[model samples]
Target: MSWIRFGRCLVAALLLLGAAGVGSAAVAPLTPDKKVERGGELTASREEFHLVVAKLLKDQGFLDKNNTFKKGTKMHRLFESYLQETLSDPAVMDFLYTSLKENAEHVTDFDAFGKALAGEYAVRGLTRLSESDFQELLRVMNVLADRLPVRDCAGMLRPGSAFDYHWLELLPLDDARVYLRLTKQALVAEITRSPRIAANTKEQTSVAYQALYAEIRRRLAPEKLERFGKIWGKPEAAGDEELCWGYRVLLSGILDLPVEPRRWMLREYANLLRPPQ
Candidate 1:
């Protein structure tokens, strides 16, 4: 059966077991055993359990748009149903309780317990994840990426293309030029630092760095190249405060480039640039 279908059936079976009071004599509370005294109030774990149940119901769309877990709300009814039909099942409750209690000590609250359960479920679910599950995950990730304020520029910048100058238009022209230069330098540095290239003789290494940097520089605007030379021509530019910060941000983005084609492309470029024996 599909995982979601199996999950629903398991939940239904547990509900039937709960209704029949199976293992009722050995039933256990889903919360930690200890209680804290404060203003004669409910323990934090109890409060957290209510909040967690409410959140789960809301996330699952079991709650009405305007409904909350107030005393008389539909959300509250759903939560009650969950408690009676699922949490009350001795097998379900005991499994969750034992899983959390055994793996985590700070799970004294229901929120912590819920998070712990989620982590455990995720790990176990991986064993059953199918190709469709992976595709769905990718779909969801794409949707989320599209909604993010910052655009995902993954794979947009090719090795021989001028870095997209439009992305840096918000900065001063000089700053933009510096950013582009630093970004290229960072890329070259990364290419040379690769163990495949770095293990070579010093002359071979220098040739590789120069060949890669030359290819990249050939693609950039002449003005940008001029600005780069004007600033970085001096040895002190390597330690320049502003350039260093820009280099870090640009290098971080390069380092985080998607591993698939980009990594393979870099390896290819390194091989092609290496001096022949």
Candidate 2:
């Protein structure tokens, strides 16, 4: 099956299981302060933002370590599935944009601003995600804070690049979407170029990898894909472990996953393709 198809099937299965209360705890939804403005510039402190996000996640049963959903849930899987789906979904993205834009006034810390926006949306009926999905949402928020221009809680063309302060008043959802698409495309290309992704000696593995790579490449701009291919062909990216590590580094950079977890995931994936001793 195509990766997209596989992903849809997987999400459907997970949602079905979650709906059935399969290994899920009967957790109550959080009740945020009704006084908090639902449609205004986010002025919450960073600590307040973190507290809200944590509370919402906990309320959704995301912090339940004993849940069956944690098993086999890698950061990359979460990114590829939940984060990708959320970012690509027009309805979800539109909701996110509207929430952020409504709360975009008086925001000084972009990190806190974005989380508060997400938390606000979660409390307002965006909490239908699985535990893994919640985790991905949090991770994606972190990545956006780190990579996107957010000087003084304002989106920018680049660091130190000045623009009309009035323009910063509006939420840059269009730019945010473009950024997400580019990042996802780069991640897909990087994963496709990983040597550890397929067994070199297995024809079936080779064919599958090629087909998957072609599909991902087909979605990317020709010039962008060409640039990525050149980078992948470099000597430093040429070996099983090297390419694996390269892919891990790329993912870590984009997804904001900690080094130790990303390293462990790469090792686990490599072992799956490794020959028996």
Candidate 3:
């Protein structure tokens, strides 16, 4: 017979909402009593949980349509060049590198990134559940899982529902698909409705893309400049500040759309600059 155990501990929640900014907050860890016997539970450390959550929230549904590329449109060309340049930025690369390093340093099964960054060192306990308790946990988790937003945070610029999907998925379950959809929808609604969301989206997009472009130029070959285009040129001359800002806002709103939309936009833009066969 399978057994069930029910225990309540504080769940840590330390979510970063945007790019290249540092937030200092200590999260309390949930130390489970002991591992329950009879079933397998994948233990994840803090960094693992943080990374998982970050990936979940990185979907495209979070933005508005204006930020995304329209097929066969001039906007698509601008987007492609802008994106390549942005990705090439040094600061952005540093941010990505830092995030990755932090993730790697703290990915222990015993603790989450929340604990690791906080500099807490200790192997906490994990309570084992009876089969029945496990089922109940699953039930609760399922209900919460089903609540995940399916849309992208494109417009919201905050780590919303899709963001939660990461931590939630860590729990053993069968309702991942259902939860993921809901999370996207929830995020879309939340981001689209807020008046301030647009501003936030613009700010984040500027920071992320600008950093990316800066890094690209710093690291890549000058011969490759043609590929990125004169995007490296002054933004004022190319009307980039205005165009790019609008693009980011749009991308945040529709990040959940088929990656193809953005992908096609980028490809088309690239081909236009240097005719492709």
Candidate 4:
């Protein structure tokens, strides 16, 4: 059977037992209604995506433990299933197949396949790229960016380690700190306006943000400090553009906040990050 079907079956089984209560012997699954009302279900789940994937790779012994490592198990199976389904998708397979067919004579290595795909997107315009394409693009980015593992860079030494959750290496500590300080305040205001989130949950988020920020501050470097300043202070400066984008994407993923507002915030911050050239 298909991976998607399998995943749904798993969820269905959990939901069934959850509904039956099983004489208090079974733990109930969080209901969809509750998840919608609380907001944490989706936010937390989405935030865990990378962390889960990281753990999966480590647990499966996919990486060289000495050089590249991860700590967590939650992301492993979920991400594996996601990749399986992604590859199984006919459109993605077709894209890969067609690209391979077109470049068969000249291109060979796995890297060449990736570059061809990226080139195809570039020619088509980013607007034309589908969600699958975007997902694939991010996979390529992870390979290219080689972002320091949360364990190594963030000072998370153990499994399930995360800033606001645990302590490890602290490489990005300072960056997380300053950004969270600004973002938590903005989110509180937004939530207050919408009332979609409970006041307690917002407070919890504040605590999470505060803890994360403190952790990040400890890891700041001189160049990163400068970059942070330029991005946060002078949004109009060209130097801040790239920095702002990095901050917006990374922190949004880390914090489980909407990227649209964060992107706007980054744009605004960019103006203050540096003087006009």
| Superposed model 2: Cα runs more than 4 Å off | 1-73, 123-277
Off by over 4 Å in 3: 1-71, 105-277
lDDT at position 123, candidate 3 = 8
Model 4 worst lDDT run, 10 consecutive residues: 20-29
Rank ordering of all candidates by lDDT, starting from the highest: 2, 1, 4, 3
Instruction: Point out the higher-scoring one by TM-score: 3 or 4.
Output: 4
lDDT of 3 at 172: 33
List the candidate numbers ranked by TM-score, top first: 4, 1, 2, 3
Model 3 lDDT tens row, 1-277:
1001000000001011211011111122222223211133434443454444344234333211222345564344443333333323333233333433445434454334433432211101001112222223224333432333322222121333122223333333444433332222222222233111111233443343333344444644676533234322222233423323322322232222234333332222112222111
On TM-score, the candidate that comes out on top is 4
Whole-model lDDT per candidate: 0.33, 0.34, 0.29, 0.31
TM-score to native of every candidate shown: 0.25, 0.21, 0.18, 0.27
Superior candidate under lDDT, 1 versus 2: 2
Q: Summarize candidate 1's per-residue lDDT along 1-277 as a digit string, tens digits.
A: 4323432342232222211111011111233333322222334453454455445444434333222245553234443443344443334444454445454544446544453353333222221223233223223323322322232222121112112223333444443333333222222222233223223454543443344344335544777545434433331333333233322232232233344323332333233333323
Clashes of each: 0, 3, 62, 29
- Candidate 3 local accuracy as lDDT? 0.29
Question: Residue 202 deviation, candidate 4, in Å?
Answer: 32
Q: In terms of lDDT, which candidate is strongest?
A: 2
Which candidate model has the greater TM-score, 1 or 2?
1
Candidate 1 deviant stretches above 4 angstroms: 1-94, 100-107, 151-277
Q: Model 1 TM-score? A: 0.25
Give the winner by lDDT: 1 or 4. Answer: 1
